[model samples]
Target: MASREGSLSVVIPAFNEAGNIGDLVIETIDAVPASLLREIVVVDDCSDDGTEDVLKRLSVTIPALRYVRHGARAGQSAALRTGVRTATAPLIATMDGDGQNDPRDILKLLAALEAPSGETVVLAGGVRTQRR
Candidate 1:
């Protein structure tokens, strides 16, 4: 089994999350095993909230950060599919960009994937706290 330090890709779907993208990226980086997931792809669904601008600014500093925009405004699922298809890593992880999911739990999910049972599993975490 490969350690969590192996290469991994994180895909985030954004739809008007100009306010959350930056912080989300930072938290995701902090949560992932540094040696494992150095690349993150943020797929925007043709957001009109200046998300493109934020990403443009971020790309300058975050070397592993990648921003992909839908030629037309596609839904979240489409954006997710795009990000996954474009990912360069053998393993891919996804998280919501609405500030609802905790990035710190990423490691736990990765650990689940490495379980010794040798069975395929999909790990999902639900938030009990409400955003309202």
Candidate 2:
């Protein structure tokens, strides 16, 4: 197990994903251990739907949940960059908001990074074989 120093931040970039955002947020919160998670930052790319409202409500319920809405519609990459820029944690873990990525994989990635090894690994990630 890795040390729970509140060092990791989860950044989710969403665009018009009102239907999936709330569940994803709740699932992400539940998947990550409280001690290891510093915060969860959701960057909304000017979603026309109710994603902003959902995030606002979730933020009130989850202390670690923070969100930012772009003034204009930006693509997913731009949303990710914005989230990364706004994140406060040194270690950032990014995931899609459309529920394509598994929240539990975050722990696996963290464990892989923390594992002792003679050779350095630059990154650890899982492939998404099935799209929802």
Candidate 3:
């Protein structure tokens, strides 16, 4: 079963998430199956809040982490574009940097993608329920 499901690429775009990037990376690493995850790309959009620094520091701990540096502060779309272009994996995943989304949810998406007869499906994230 593991051999059938292809690799996954997770793209995390950050502008000023120095305080959250470390934890987020750790949680994301722990959340997904190591065999399924190809890489985790964190695109730094010229963040002034030391996000790039945080990512560099994190690379020491997270081996799967890859950093993409931007010259200036670009919007999320630009960051995402950079990430997607740089990613080598066929399955690309994206998430926000505010720490609101749970990394564990990635498993659900991966499972759904592995479902029989489910191909060429683009998963767009939608928040319609509250945990409370």
Give the number of the best model, judged by TM-score.
2
lDDT of 2 by residue, 1-132 (tens): 456578889999999999999999899989998888889999999999999999999888899998898999879999999999999987889999999998988988887776486667657887877777
Ranking by lDDT: 2, 3, 1
Candidate 3 lands at a TM-score of 0.87
Range of the 10 consecutive residues with the lowest summed lDDT in candidate 3: 123-132
- 16-119: candidate 1 lDDT, tens digit per residue: 99998888988887887668885899999999998888887988988788999998988999999999998998778888778777877677766776658887
Instruction: Give the better candidate number (1 or 2) by TM-score.
Output: 2
Highest-scoring model, lDDT: 2
lDDT of 3 by residue, 16-49 (tens): 9998888888889998888888889999989998
Arranged by TM-score, best first: 2, 3, 1
TM-score, one value per model: 0.86, 0.92, 0.87
lDDT of 2: 0.89
Clashing residue pairs in candidate 1 are none
* Location of the lowest summed lDDT over 10 successive residues in candidate 2: 113-122
